[model samples]
Target: MTSYLIKSILCSGILIVVYHLFLEREKMLWFNRFYLLSALVFSLVVPLISFEIKPENVLKPVITAVPQIMEEMQKTGVINSMIATAESNSPPDTMQLLLFVFDGICLLLLIRFLVNVSSVLRLKSRCRNVKIASAKLILVPENIVTYTFLNNIFIPEKTFENAQVRDEILAHELAHARQMHSLDVIFIELIHVFLWVNPFLFWYKKAIRLNHEFLADEAVLKEYTNVKSYQLLLLDTVLQGRQMALTSSFNYSITKKRLAMMTKIKNLNRQYIKQGAIAVLAFVLTLTFSEKIYAQIEFKSKEVAATFPEISIVRFEAVADKPAKKPDQKGKSGPGISKAEIDEFYKTIERNTTYVKNKKGRTDPMVRMEPKMEDRMYELFSQMDTDQLQMAADSGIMVFQMPIPVKKAPTPEMFENWKKPEIFGIWINEKHVPNSELNKYKYSDIAEYSLSKLYGGALKGRIYKYQLDILTNEEFDRTYDRRANDRVIITRVGWVGENRPKSFAGRRI
Candidate 1:
């Protein structure tokens, strides 16, 4: 919603600047009126339109690698201890509070609009009517400026005595009545009730009112013979102009512009050139506004791949073993299993297992496990390395793969103690869950998990912390089939970090 408001405001501002630059001084009164109205409608609608450019299927290979590793981890029981935790800093009720404030402001403006319309109706009812040519002349008791609302031309009761001034006022107001300029004023007032926050709308209203005056002035000059006398009559009535939004007054604020427009020569030959330029400008503005609309949509595949950079797995290392305690002379037991027993168990597993070596001579443990014997394989490994296994349980170590060498590594001090992983939160479909509810599900139920940073107003400078996104099997299979090279992106989370398969930047995940 906020993004849409911003886009609307920006689009309105650009259109208004274009009007002031090219169309303001042109004698095309109807063109200017339509242009300003079109701008208003465009501002309200353009933000809702969305356009997207589909990227080519060039990234399929890079994205398949992460899912393969995830599959291997599930089979090997590596992700059994995975845990996640996240902290929300934004107040839960802030969005509601903002909406309430906005609605209240709009309500007040709506009431003001109603009041202005009612006041005009009240004035019309109280005035005395007298017919003059094709217009209904309304003689008011108060000393107010002459103006037109609908077919009624209002004038001060005293103006009836001065025939010349009365005729001039009547002619000017008759032009307003004939042109139906009051409809434009009423339309803009209604628009103001809702979009009062946009200052460009206010400028647009002013431009509209000014163009109405130009149209009326042109109409009055075509009928009235004495030009100099009419000019003097305008100067005389300037001070008596009333500040009313609902009515088109004879003497509007822009008296100087009116006088200049009257004498300005019409250039009919240049009309086509100016019209062509306006058409070109409109096309350019449409493209500009369309770009803003398209910016709001999330990209499908290529964008996801760009977010998760390729991270090479180096090797796996067993955490350092603790020293074993000796038995007491009294034949009492010590705190832990003896070192000789642990060594013997480790030797038995090593003799039975086979490890595959890659081109870099790094060993992959998953390659040795048989398909149906996973449970028995896990039982053998668990019994052989009970101490390290217990440490993995308490520390929440999912898979302990070393990361490829990079420019910067976590400080050695970060690894001095067996640092337990800090569970932040679980994310499914980009929504955070503050508890371990996901642990009830089997690893096969989950397709894959991506480590990325969560972003929001609440999470502002804490972008380095990792968010674990768990994808359901269905979502994973569909994405993998449609765009296998595309990464499974968790919306509202930023790109994955450079350091992979380790504590995020030395801080526990």
Candidate 2:
């Protein structure tokens, strides 16, 4: 909302400057009227236009290593202390307050607008109707200047009674009525009520009213012979009486400019040049005030793997023509962890594990550390290549050990319990299967299975917290174990063993 308002103000300000500089002094009255009205409408709409910019450069997909957590512990005593500092103590919203103040002022302005309309209607009802020059004239008894409101022309009783006053005053008000200038006045005033804070609105109101006066003065000059005498009449009505907000009054502070414009000679060539300039400005502003969007392309298959070798884990062939950036190139390279930093991380882990076991007496194997494990861990880091090392640095791994739980040979009852509806989801042989299909696989047929927690607790409107995956012995040896032929290697901060050994699965000592 704030961005839209700022853009609108900027666009209107620039267009108004162009009007004052090039078009204001010209005798192209109708063109000036069109420019002012269209400028306001265009300012509010141009910011919504958008253009999408598609770049030729392609971006490589980055892969991250993840470690699964088996269990977690927290202190329940801090719950009350945390709840006491919730959002209730936060500060009030500034935008809501501003909207409230804006609405209040707009409401007041609307009431004042209604009161002005009511005053005009009341004067219309009390005046004695006098038909003059094929239009009904309302001879107002109050001491107010001659003004036009919608189709009604209000003339002061004295001005109507005076024999000396000519029909130029009547002619001016009738032009306003014929051209329906009251609609423009109402439109701008209502806009002013809502956007009262914008400084450009004041300038807009002044320009629009001045343009209306110019049009009316031209209309009067077409019917009358002498332009000087009409200028004198405008001068005499300078301080005639008060004017209503919703009406086009005869008297304006810019009387001198009106008189000068009447005698100013029209240049047809200059008018055409100004119109062409306005067309160019509109085109430029449409481009300037619009939004720009960038397009992204996605790559799939083995082609991606050969092109983006630095991506670490490539699943597709190399088919892209553009070569990937070299690791030594001076662009955005991945973070590198120093030897000292790795040693600090090891010390922090050792300290925390020792504290948990000694102080809390926790016997969970996941939290326990094996003896002389740091030597094997440091050796794993030393063998990694540039991409592997950079990926490890970016993962921000906190713990150094990850353990996979092993279960005994499964029974029919155990297999039945796994199929319960209480579980979040189940996958058999890496394919999601229904519950009825689970009856076909016996307990002895199962080779390996794992239960893992889902970080996104709920997905696609289902309450999912944990996922269970099972692999039949046939599927395990034939596909699962040999799946590494594609060489999708992942780097993690932990002990390693091949095929997940009984104690530490991938631990290479």
Candidate 3:
């Protein structure tokens, strides 16, 4: 809101300067009036008009390890250091207090404006009205100066005794009345009530008043051939015209400019050039203003990422240690396996063994064995058919066959239950996902997967490993794993994809 006001003031100032340079002495009163009024309206409205144009392509930046430091700081609740510093250094509610002060000033100015308007209305009620030609002259009983409000011209009763002076003053005030210059005065006065703090508004009011005088002087001179005679009359009645806030008076201390305009010759060529320049200037300002408005209104995706940096999973691995075994107590033979028990255990293993098809579609041995142990294990399963071997593979492992079946590929879900290392951590797009959620996804649903080591800040020399799995459409198919220490996943749904480009120059590290 404050920025909008500042832009409005700047635009208005530029327009006023243009007017003074080009149209002020052009002799086109109505055009000048419309231009000034339009300038005011344009300045107020231009800041609100915004146009957003989407580029055909948007480039994405590489998420470097540097931003990982910000992610770590955020996790530790220390990323708001700048905000903490600002709060500690600055006064609380300072901006709010300033706004309150500004509002108070505007209110006071509005009251003053209303009071001045009411004073004019009161004066009009007390005056006596008499119609002369087309103007309704209001004769005030007090020994005060002359001024015109709307269609009524107010003058002192004592001034009526001098017929010649009265005629000149009436002619000047009548011009103001016929042209409806009081409306302009009231319009500026109302604007002043709200924008009283703007110094330009004060000067703008003076410019408006001076222009009104120029217009009235032009109207009066159209009838009277003697410009010099009119100048003398202006000099004489200048002291007789009282300045009023909401009315156009015969004189408002702009006598010299008015007299000078009367004698000044119009230059058509110079006027045309200036008008062209002003038009071009206005066009350029409008384009610039619209761009500013668009910048304020439009939201950038990159900025959102900057505000909340993403935390990618860099690596994932299973825990290496197995459960500890109980210590055996000293006895005659502590819990020695009996020959019958060994036979039963071997029988149990043989019953459970099965052979399953591997990735090659071959029904290999259900369990892997050393080259030397392979023949011995095969001898036990020599009579077994491919189907029987496959069934044995499906069942699990046998000791005499082999200790365990060929290792089945792990699914996304299996990784969830797999014992994770105590120091291992995982994150998906800056959010922590529990093992429960991680287990729900299938491996093939992942469009891209890799392992990487993040390095920066305290992690500069040290490497923190993680796994990055970017899903295609959150669905499942087959399972496969390929390992890369440092990799990028460009998937359609997550990571760098269609909307996010490969590289962006404007990205902040």
Once model 2 is optimally superposed onto the true structure by TM-score, how far is the C-alpha of residue 8 displaced, in angstroms?
Answer: 0.6
| Candidate 1 least-lDDT 10 residues | 318-327
Model 1, 1-509: lDDT tens digits are 56667778888988888888877887888888888888888887877654443322111121222443433443454433332122244354896898888889899988988888788778878878888777787877777877788888877777765553556567778888887878877777777777777788888877888888888887878888677887898887778446566788755468888888788786877867877876777677566665321111133321222212333431221111111121111221234444564444333333433343333334322112222233333333334344444433332221111122112211232111112223233555445443355545555565555433223321232222333455666665556543432222211111222332223223333
Q: Which stretches of model 3 miss by more than 4 angstroms?
A: 53-92, 161-165, 240-242, 250-252, 291-509
True-structure lDDT of candidate 3: 0.52
Model 3, residue 250: C-alpha shift (Å): 4.1
Tens-place lDDT per residue, model 2, 169-218, is 88998898889898888887887777676678788888888889999999
* C-alpha positional error of residue 34 in candidate 1 after TM-score superposition, expressed in Å: 1.4
lDDT of each: 0.54, 0.60, 0.52
**C-alpha lDDT (0 to 100) for residue 43 of candidate 1:** 80
- Lowest-lDDT window of 10 residues in candidate 2? 65-74
Error of 2 at 318 (Å): 21
Q: Which runs in model 2 stand beyond 4 Å of their true positions?
A: 55-92, 131-135, 161-165, 296-509
What is the Å distance of residue 154 in model 2 from its true position?
0.5
